[model samples]
Target: GKKVIIIGAGIAGLAASIRLSIKGFQVDVFEANSYPGGKLTEIIMDGYRFDAGPSLFTLPEQIDELFALAGLKTEDFFRYKRLEVNCNYFWEDGARLSAYSDLDKFTKEVAYQFGEQPENIKKALDKSAYIYKYLAPLFMHRSLHKWSTWLNKKAMASYFRIGKFGLFHTMNQANQRQFKHPKLAQLFNRYATYNGSNPYQTPATLNIIPHLEFNKGAYFPTEGMHSITSSLYTLAKQLGVNFHFNKAVDKILVKDKVAIGIQAGGKSYDGNYILNNMDMVTAYKTLLNEEKQPTRLLKQPKSSSALIFYWGVKKVFPELDLHNILFSKDYAKEFKAIFKDKDIDDDPTVYINITSVQKANDAPEGAMNWFTMINVPNDQGQDWEYLKAKARKAIIRKINATLHTDIEPLIEVEQILDPIGIATKTSSANGALYGNSSNNRYAAFLRHPNYSSKIKNLYFCGGSVHPGGGIPLCLLSAKIVADMIPKP
Candidate 1:
């Protein structure tokens, strides 16, 4: 059997290991951290457990597909429940919107709260669904760099219909055209942030994100988001895949433009195939160590990073759901601050995710685990300590004002994760969460492909590669890499 050396035990790396193992390849995963899951890992502090990264769970079938490929029942290994309330939105002007899982309920709620017509809401959602269905086969499910992908009849059909996908207009323009109310437009505009793009600059193609959460329904694993990592890691172990923790790859051993193995921990391991789950730019500079770099790919503008405050609250609110968003009053100014100025806005949008609402064991008897996050520019020599202090004050002011509750006294434990910490921990270039920003219309085609054109038997996966970031896309990246590999 051919041997595969997978770098980073992230979702993509683990998923690739499972697929390759099933394909009769002997797979071994090397992770730098002591634990698995990369950005999908967890944090435990002061009797509170939090999903340290990727709080939202959507398109769970991507995770389940791995189990199915291994000839196992998905339910036996992983379990999750569809959330009744997708998210609760809060506005400073005393407006509260409950995004319901049911389509009719959501449409009616939008109509009642935002004064938007139900017909318009349905039309917008239908448009989102149509865009996703129309482009999934061409842009998402297959590799754009491969000639095989372009030759397909489905790809040809999708290419011809690309004009209807709204490549010209910005996401904000699309949302504005669909709804008269600014609130409704703001609600849809938030979808651009899913891939760390500014709605004002990103293409309307991102409008398809709403369909995944609203129409397909958001979900939560019964054991919290960490279970996504634990379950997959467990499956890889059961498949005879060896995992080496705390082992960082120092170099991609190459000869004559062909990847041979990995050099890690002052030792070498030979493999027929090498898959790098590390960020693409970091892999080139740190591991590849060549004088010449992929200049164009490296120069791409980075996606926005995050400032997360994991708080162990001493109290819980009945009104708050598992996912909550306190939107900023001036959304455009907020994006401008992050993208153009490279600083966080004083009135930044705040997102709080409390897993204890669903899994009781995540916190103490009555307390809650709050994963409070706000988007910020990727690291660029900014003073994070000063920025964090300012952000905390701003966040408290917003939450207290919107919720009408003095939340300062409710905090018993706190841990902060800034872009600096994220970059140091995950090796993401410039601490960008989703790799590169999708702000440009061509950004979809600009992402680094899953397979390296310059090197033979070298493949890439994870957020930094093709299909883009988040758990679903990372899984898709692994599938793309596995498919591109020839049968052993």
Candidate 2:
């Protein structure tokens, strides 16, 4: 069998390994960390287990497709149930909304809470579906950098329809124009942060995000988010893929415009093809140091990072669901604090995801694991110690005000993950969560391609490359790369 060396055993890398191994390739995956899953790993605090990264689970069909390709039952490896209640939204003024998976119920709930016209809510959801329908096949499922993608009649048709389906407006502008109440607009505008983009600057095309959660339905794994990694790792191993942990790759061994293999742990392992699934910026700065860098793509504005507080709360509120959003009063100011001022807003929008609600074993009896997070600027030499301390207070204040409970005392155990910590741990440049921000409508076309332009037999896959971030997109990136490499 032909050999393929996969770098960084992230979600994309794991997916790529599975696909290539099925295609009759000897897949050898090398990971820097002792365990796989990249940012999709988990943490434990005082008997409470929290998914360290990528809490929200959507588009599980992407994972199912891999197992299907292997002719294996996905349920045997991994399983997830669609959430009936997608998320619970809370405002400071005592306005609460339960976004349901059922469109009729959600429309009625929104109408009851915000007095928004049910027809308007449905229309807004239809618009999101419209955008996702035309864009997914062309921009998301395929490689944007390839000429064949633009030349194909079907993809070209979809590409041209973007002007019609995806309105030329910022997420904030589109929501403001679509809804009468600012609260409803703010609720929809929060979708931009799904990819770590500023709603005020990111193109309104991002509004399609709601379609996934509401229309397709949000889901939670039977175990926890970490099970996503564990299951995939197990599947990859079953397919005869090799994994070497704690062997951080030193460099990509390239020769005469061809990727030969990689140097890791002071030794070199040659392969027929090399696939880099690490962040593009760090890969260029370190792995491909000798090669000419794609400066423009690397210089593009990075997506916002996150400040996560893994708090093991001693008390559980039956009112709070698996997903909860405590919105900021000044939504625009909160975004400005992240993208412009490069600081956390005093009243930042806080997202609290509790897996314990779904899997009781995640925490102690009557307790919950709070994966509390707030979007923040990526690393820029700022004082993270000060910011983390300040943000912690702001978060506590926001939670107390919205939940009507002094949560500071409920904390039995606490652990923090800042941008600096994320950067150091994951080797992600600036700790940008989703690689490049889709701030502009053209951001999709600006992302690095799935394969290296200068180096032959060199491929790229991951959130940092094409098709963007999140679990689904990362899985798609791997499919794109695996498709690009010809089977022996």
Candidate 3:
């Protein structure tokens, strides 16, 4: 078997290394940062811990499969519990909604809160399930470029059922058709942001997101979200996978259009295959500079980025749940500012996630660890400092008004993550959270492929490439990359 070199120690890289090692291939992962996990990381501030990125966890089966492949028991290393209450929502009109994990309970709640019929909710879920059934095999489980995939009977069936996938209209339109109440429509439309997209413009195929959460059930990692990274890293190391930390890969050596190795820390590490788990944009621009880049795909519009504030609160709110969203009155205007105007909305909807509720060790006995986030436009030469300060004040005011608590005074510690910070830390271009925006119908096909068409032995994984971002899809991206590698 040939030696494999992987760039970046993110979840995708770790997963690839584990899979390759189990297949009897020698795997060496080169990570620029001292720690692994990239965005799936943790930050400890004065004893309060926060999973710096991706608070919500869904699809535990995908993670368990990785452990099983490594010949390890999933329970022995990692564990998670399904969330009973997925999230709590607050509206501007003094209305509140507790999104329960139980489907019947949630449907009844929606019906009770808004005068919408439960049958309408059931119909929407049925449609979403149909979309998932057709698209999963074609778009998710296999590579679209592969000949075998296209030739398969399942692929042919998917091709015929493409109309049901809603390739023509936007997600907002689809939701509006499903629910008569504007609030209910807005509630479903919010799922589009799970991947950092605008529902009004993004394809209705995105409606499948809610089915992933409410149907499959959302989860909370027992030790916290960062435990996911820690457990995977441990499993990878235990499987005889080597990791070179703080070693930035400077270039991907190409000989006769074939990748031979990678150059990092003034030395060459040769390998039969190269998996780039770094951002696709940075991987090509920095590592494979001599190769011709995918200009059209690279130039495609990016999804919205987030401006986050990690606060160590001195007091805990009993009214707040593990996940909470404070919706803005004008949802259309808010998205318009992000997608069309390319700026932060004046009244941006705020999402506050408190991990201390689930894991008491995350904060002191009387305090809470708050992960506050708001969607914003990707970096396009905006004045971030000014916008961040202004947004912070507005968020404080909004929370105070809605919760009836002056939250500003209880902030014991404060840290921020903006678009610039996101880009610098994760190597993502324009700090796009989930790669290119799904605003257009062609975005699914327009995304950069896991394997390079131009450069042999060079491959891509992680959020920026196929399968797209978020924890579940990022794991799927790694699976696609690993499957593409030649067997020993």
Candidate 4:
């Protein structure tokens, strides 16, 4: 069997390692961190456990597909339940809404709370489904850079219908036109943030994001989000894939324009092929410095990052679901702060995810673990210390007003992860949560491809590459990379 070397052990890297090994390649994964999982890892302090990153779990079939390929039952190794209540909403004005997982129920709640027609919400989601149905098959499932993909009759059909996607309109424009009330438009507009994009500037084609939650559904792993990584990591090891931790890859060794191996841990380990799972920007700046850089893709704007406060609270709030959003009063103004001004607004939208709501062990008895976060511009050499201080104050103020509690006093244990920490830990350039902001209509097409054009036997996967970020898209990136590789 031919040997392959993979850099990074992020979700996409783990999935790709398993897929490659199953295809008869001797896979060796090198991760800089002492542990695997990258951002999709965990944290424990003062009897509370928190998923460090990427809380939302949609497209369970992506994880299921990996297990199915390995000849195992998915539930036997990993388990998750569909969230009945997707998320609870709160506004400073004392308005509230419960987003039930059931489409009919959610639509009814939207209508009842926001005074929009129930049918209108359904129609909007249907349009989202239409885009996802057509767009995913054509662009997401395969490599857009490949001519064969463009030549496919199915892709041709999708290309002809681009106008129907509202590609010319901004997401805000689409949402506002669809809803009579400002709140409903604001609620749907928040979907743009799923990929760290700004609805005011991002293309309406990104509206397909909602269908994933409202139609296909969102879920939670029974063992917490870290289980997604642990279960897959265990499966990869069991399948005979070798992983080297704390071995940072400093350079990608290439020979005559062909990727040959990696230089890591001050040693060179050769391979027949190279699978680079590192963030694209960081990889070019560090690992593949000598290789011809894809400057165009590199120039694409980095997506918004986050400022998270992992707090172990002394009490629980029954009104809160597994997910809760304390929306800012002015949604458009909030986005302007993040994207244009490169700062967080005084009233930034705050997201609170409590895994303890489902699994009791995540927090101490009669307590909750709050994964509180707010979106901010990715690290541009900003004064994060000042930003963090301002953000903490704003988050405390919002939570106090919306949830009706003095949360600062309830915090028994606390830790903070700003964009600088995110970049330092994950090697995601500029600490961008997603590789690039899908602000432009062509962002989906502009992402780096699965395989390198100039470097043979060199491939790229993970959130930084084609198909974009999040758990599902990262898995899809692995699939696309695997499909392109010939069996060993």
Candidate 5:
């Protein structure tokens, strides 16, 4: 069997390791951190647990498939429930909307609160579902860069239906055309941010994002989001995938434009196949320093980063669920600050994820663990200290005004994760949550491919590569990378 080496033990790395090992390849994974999961990891402070990154959970089938591949039941190793109430949205004007997982309930709620026609909401959802059905088969399931993908009947059919995707217009324009109410349009437009994209600039095809949560349904693991990592890691270990934590890969040793091994700890460990789970830009500049790099892909606009405040509150709010969104009054202005001005918005949209709402021991009795976050531009040598300070104040003000509570006083324990910290921790270029913004219509195709074009026997996976970021996409990247590899 050919030996394969995976750099970084992120979700994609772990999944790739498992997939390759199952395919009869000897797999070894090297992670710079002491633990696995990358951005999907966890943090615990003062008995309050928080998922360090990616709070939302969708696409349970992707996680389950890994266990099934190992001849095990998903429930035995990992378990999750579909969230009945996916998220509760709040506006500055005291208007509230609960996005019920049930389509009928969600339509009724939207109609009652925003005075929009129920059928209009339903029609929009139906369109979103339609777009996803076409796009997922074309864009997600396979690599766009490969000629084999384009020759398919399904992809050709999807290409013909491209006009229905509204690729010419921005997401905001599409939403505005669908809904008469500003709030409803804003709600739909926010879906662009799911991929770290600007709604005003990104193609309306991204409207497919809402369908994932609303039609397919949002979910939560029984233990916590981090369990997704821990369980997969456990399975990988059981499948004989070797992991070397706290081992930073210094160089990807190449010969004849082919990946042969990695240099780490001043030693060389050779392999037949090498898969990089690190951010593609960092991988090129650092590991593949001597190799011909893909400059155009490396130079794509980095996606928005985040400023997170993990607070252990002494009190609980029953009105809040697993996910709550406190939207900015001026959505367009907020994006401008992120993409154009390269800073946080004065009125940034705040997302609060309370895992303790489902996991009882995540916080002390009568206390809640609030993972509060706001989107900001990625790291660019900015004064993060000043920005974080200003953001804290602004976030506190927003939360207080929307929730009708002095949230600052309820903080019994606290920790913060800023862009600088995220970049340092995850090795994500510029601390971008997603590798690149999908602001441009071609972003989906512009992402770095799963396999390197210039380097043979070298592959890439994770949020930084093909198919974009988020748990599901990262997992899909692993599958695509695995599919690209020859059988052992």
Candidate 6:
């Protein structure tokens, strides 16, 4: 059997290992961190457990496909339940809106809270669903560069409907046109952050994100987000896949422009195929030193990063849901601060998630774990310590004002993760959550391809490469790489 060496034990790497092993390839995974899951990790503090990254769960069918490929039942290994309420939004004008999973309930909630016409909300959702219908088969299911894509009838139909997909206008502009209320526009425009793009700059193609969450439904894992990593890792190990933890890969060994193996921990491991799950910037600048990098593509602006504060609160609120958002007054200014100014906004939108709401064991008898986060620009040599302090103060003030509760006294433990920490921990350049910013309409085509055109037998997967970021897309990237590998 052919041997495959996968760099980084992230979701993409682990998923690739499962697919390749099923195809009769001997797979070995190397991880720099002691644990797997990359950003989809968990933390426990003072009797409260918090999911470190990726608080939202959507499109679980992608995960089910992986388990089915391994001949295992998804329910037996991992389990998740659909959320009744997707998220709770708190606007600066003291408006509270509940985003229900049910389409009718959500439309009614929009009407009740924002005074938006139900017909308008229905029309907007219809447009979002239309975009999804036009693009899903072409953009999400398969690689765009494949010859079969051009030949497929569905793909051609998607190409014909591309203009209607809102590729020209920004998501903010599209939302404003669909909804008369500014708050309603803000609600839909916020979907741009699903992939960490600025709504003011990101194309309206991102409006399709709502359908993935609302129509398809949002989910919460039974155990926690980390359960995804644990279940997949367990399955991979059962398949005879070797995992080498704390082994940092130094370089990709190449012979005549073909990948041979990887150099890690001052040792060389020979393999027939190499899969890189590391960020594209680091993979090129560090691993493939001799190879010519894509300079123009690499120079594109990166997606926004995040500043997360994990607080072990001594109390819980009945009004708060599992996922909550405290939106800033000026959404456009917030995006400008992240993209153009490259600074943390004083009035940044804050997202707070509590796992204890679903899984009781995640916290003590009456306590809660608050995973508070705010979007910021990717690292560009900013003074983070000062910014972190300022941002924390602002976030706390916003939460207290919106919730009408003094929350400062309830903290039993506190920890902070900034852009620098995210970069250092995951080796993502500038600590970008998603690889590159999709502000440009051509970003989908311009992203680094899954298979390296310059190097033979070398493939790339994860947020930094094709198909884009988040758990589902990262898993799709792995599938693309596995499909590209020839059968023995």
What is candidate 1's lDDT per residue for 298-341, written digit by digit as tens? 99999999999999998878888999999999999999999999
| Candidate 3, position 208, lDDT | 87
Native-referenced Cα lDDT, model 3: 0.90
Task: Name model 5 segments beyond 4 Å from true.
Answer: none
- In model 1, which runs have C-alpha deviations exceeding 4 angstroms? none
What pairs collide in candidate 6? none
Error of 5 at 406 (Å): 1.2
What lDDT score is found at residue 374 in candidate 4? Answer: 98
Among residues 3 or more apart in sequence or in different chains, the pairs in candidate 1 whose N, CA or C atoms overlap within 3 Å are none
Global lDDT of each candidate: 0.92, 0.92, 0.90, 0.93, 0.92, 0.90
lDDT of 2: 0.92
Per-residue CA lDDT of model 3 for 115-180, tens digit only, reads 789899888988888888888888887777778878989989989888889888999999999999
Tens digits of per-residue lDDT, candidate 5, 1-488, equal 79999999999999999999999999999999999999998999888899889888988999889999989999999999999999999987899999999888988898899889988888898999999998897789888789988898988888888789979999999999999899999989988888888999999999999888988889999899999999999999999999999999999999998999999999999999999999999999999888888889899998888899999999989889999999999999999999999988889999999999999999999999999999989999999999999999999999999989998889998899999899999889999999988999888878999998888999999998889998889999999998889997
What TM-score does candidate 6 reach?
Answer: 0.98
Query: What's the count of clashing pairs in each model shown?
Result: 0, 0, 0, 0, 0, 0
- Model 5 has an lDDT value of 0.92
Which window of ten consecutive residues has the lowest lDDT sum in model 2? Answer: 158-167
- Please give the RMSD to the true structure for each candidate, in Å: 0.9, 0.9, 1.0, 0.8, 0.8, 1.0
Q: Candidate 6, 446: how far from true, in Å?
A: 1.6
lDDT of 3 at 94: 91
Worst 10 residues of 4 by lDDT: 107-116
